[model samples]
Target: MPYDPPPELAGLSLAQIAEQVAARNLPPLDTWDPPETEHSGMRITADGRWFHRDSPITRPAMVRAFASLLRREDDGRYFLVTPHHKQAIDVEDAAFIAVDCKADGDALAFRLNTDELVLAGPHNPLRAQGDADTPAIYLSVRHGCEARLDRSTWLQLADIALADGGDLSVGSQGATFALRPA
Candidate 1:
């Protein structure tokens, strides 16, 4: 969806704009379903890199702008949706990577590759796929999309993951999510 920024942001600094964008009120993606369109030039790599026509999108600002436009539909495909258009994009893994995370008191908040923030708790739980020795970590982003946690970030999260009996759990905000679902 096209964001018509509040007129007040016109004079803000880049950092300020980024902060606003990070916390901006987003349209309810669940409510949007425009007709599907095609755009084969855009691709999100396995490591969360964006490319256009086989060239890496090196500009961080442009990448962030594109990230804001992404939407994953129910069919397990990703798209860039606007009020008027919904165009397909290739996602090798996921659209974003959970690069790092920090704690707000006991609440864990993750920082995705897009710089979007998500807290891990009951609403946005952490998940582990495959065997514990080598697993894929994922954090729910929004809607039905998710961000895969890179090994370093997943290890960081593991450090804080609480041990409950034989299961690994992430305890925050009075809830605990077992990494290996019980």
Candidate 2:
């Protein structure tokens, strides 16, 4: 089946976005600590491309399925977890890419390359790093995973920040986020 992207963030209300986020039923990666471990030889590029043995994984469904099983350990390692086994995967940068973003009322919604919907809030905050010359923005996805905003999505969030104030900050879910270095 072909992957159908979600409707644009602009058209969705905060409640609607929350509904979509809640609708996703993921595996219990946190509880499933399988005794078996292996290296899957899968890697996620900085730009959100999934590769195995250096060849791109072209199927969207496969990518999405793998992404759902991804978990980041406290030691900064990523793994694709199943009930029976946990396989290591290399991540060039973030595990996912925020390909699209929009400001909805007091909330900010983002769509990942895997078509996952994330709402920026207290739980899933946005973090800005790097210096003025080279800036990078990331949104916390879940289970210690983050999504780096792509160029256009970063620009869209920047515009929203500037529209709100000169502080280069935006508020969502009763929390404020700075778009630039302090």
Each model's TM-score?
A: 0.79, 0.95
Clashes of each: 0, 0
Q: How close to the true structure is residue 133 of candidate 2, measured as C-alpha lDDT?
A: 72
Off by over 4 Å in 2: 1-3
lDDT of 1 by residue, 4-110 (tens): 42333224444444465468666766677788777858999999999999999997778877887788778898888877788889999877899876554556666
Clashes of 2: 0
Give the Cα error of residue 62 in candidate 2, in Å: 0.5
> Over the stretch 1-182, how does candidate 2's per-residue lDDT look in tens digits?
66667788778888888999999999988888986478999999988899999999998999999999999999999999999999999999999999999888889999999989998999999999999877899999998999999999998998998889867888989999988865
Against the reference, the lDDT scores of all candidates come to 0.73, 0.91
Write down the lDDT that model 1 would get. 0.73
